[model samples]
Target: MKHNALAIALTLLLSALLGLALWWDYRRNATPHPTPGPASFPIDTRSAARPAPAPTQALPHNGLYRCDGPAGTSYQSHPCTPGSRQGDVSGGTLSTVTVPPPRPLPPPVASVETPTPKVGLIARGPRPGEGNEALCAMHERDIKRIDEAARRGQSSESQEWLREQRRWHKDEMWRLACGR
Candidate 1:
């Protein structure tokens, strides 16, 4: 029982020491970062020098394609015949002749959706004399509205207008209610 306890204690100590050693090694080898100066705000590391690709003389499918015959090579759109020196070999690329890919059938067109009419819920603030309401209560109501508007991401203009309204009301409340 004593040996088992001692073994566990030793194992824990070894693990802690191993972690400490790894941390110390990392700290010792780490390169220090210098404080960025005003000039270092914008760093341009892009290499501006790169050679342009060599132009391919082969025009893609201007009714001309590479045709390889059993005897010799010829340029034609059709397959090679025994009497004629014209046959198309698929797969390998020829520099002088360009083969266009087979035309794909177009997808079916989608129908346009009819616009759904918007039903706006009218919001009317308290009357002028109701300004004696609790300061936090008014702000809480405004905050709820702003939070809901922001969550929905429906109307940024509405949020701005609410903010403006709040600002104007705050100024008025300060003057009249607070007697500032």
Candidate 2:
């Protein structure tokens, strides 16, 4: 009993030491973050170099002026330079492609004869010896869904519970004598 107590005490001490070592290692290796304070705030280096913002007032939408400058002809929304000659801008028409309307669909043909059911509920389920393909397919789908749920990692159920559910599904497949 004393030996068991001593072993337990040693295990607890080792666990505590390991935890402390891990915590210390994490703290030492972790990136240092600057504390939020007035002195620690970042300076705007571009504040002086930055250009003043344009006026928010809307410009007049008067007709565009075509200016023939000394260098080349240029288009401007406002009056050009003092020596440059300006003209009233005109016609640059864009031709649009016209799409023809779609043709109407053909009417569905009506069936005169009534359809007869071949298999019932008992026929769909598993028989004495031979297994049902539909049930086996459904089981496979359920197993895949369970695996997907496990991978998503957002389930309210524990991993153990999910594993149990998977096992249960596999057991059900065996009980149903599927894939025979």
Candidate 3:
């Protein structure tokens, strides 16, 4: 009973000390924001007054005219005078070219037949001692080669597929009773 009471007293004292320390830290770091008072300068009056600008006259037509004079070629706001020879100003003459039709494509070549990959026996093993020793040894060698390829980061097959092949080889060895 005495130990329990002492523990409770120490816990309460530690909590109170923590609360006081947090409150002191908060008070020390906090900044007080003063309430805003009235501003010093006047903001209602307009300082300098400006006058309205004058309007401009509109043109009759916006097209530009070209005129060849004695002082070289000159551009004017008016057209070339009557009975006078005028140069072509609406872009120079255009030349046209005849394009030949594309030749028809040749017929596709016949596709060649691809040879199929060789597959091993699945689920079942060869007869024990019936020329299966060589087969089991081949499987063991395949497992070792696949493992070495994986260790050297040169494996062509996926990790999961390689693991499945290894399991198949182990199963084949067990079923053939290779070393037994």
Using lDDT as the measure, the top candidate is: 2
Looking at model 1, report the run of 10 residues with the lowest lDDT sum: 50-59
* 2 versus 3: better TM-score goes to: 2
Summarize candidate 1's per-residue lDDT along 29-128 as a digit string, tens digits: 8967676555554644464365433333443554565544455667775433445433334556646646999999999899996665545754455455
Alpha-carbon RMSD, each predicted model: 26.1, 26.8, 26.9
Candidate 2 yields a Cα-based lDDT of 0.74
How do the residues 42-115 of candidate 3 rate in per-residue lDDT, one tens digit apiece? 75456435432222322233344455555567545566554333343554443445799999999999999665
Off by over 4 Å in 1: 33-39, 44-180
Off by over 4 Å in 3: 1-130, 154-157
Residue 66's C-alpha lDDT in candidate 1? Answer: 57
The better-scoring model by lDDT among 1 and 2 is 2
Better of 1 and 2 by TM-score: 2
Question: Of the candidates shown, which would achieve the greatest TM-score relative to the real structure?
Answer: 2
Candidate 2 TM-score, C-alpha based: 0.27
TM-score, each model?
0.20, 0.27, 0.26
Per-residue lDDT of 91 in model 3? 43
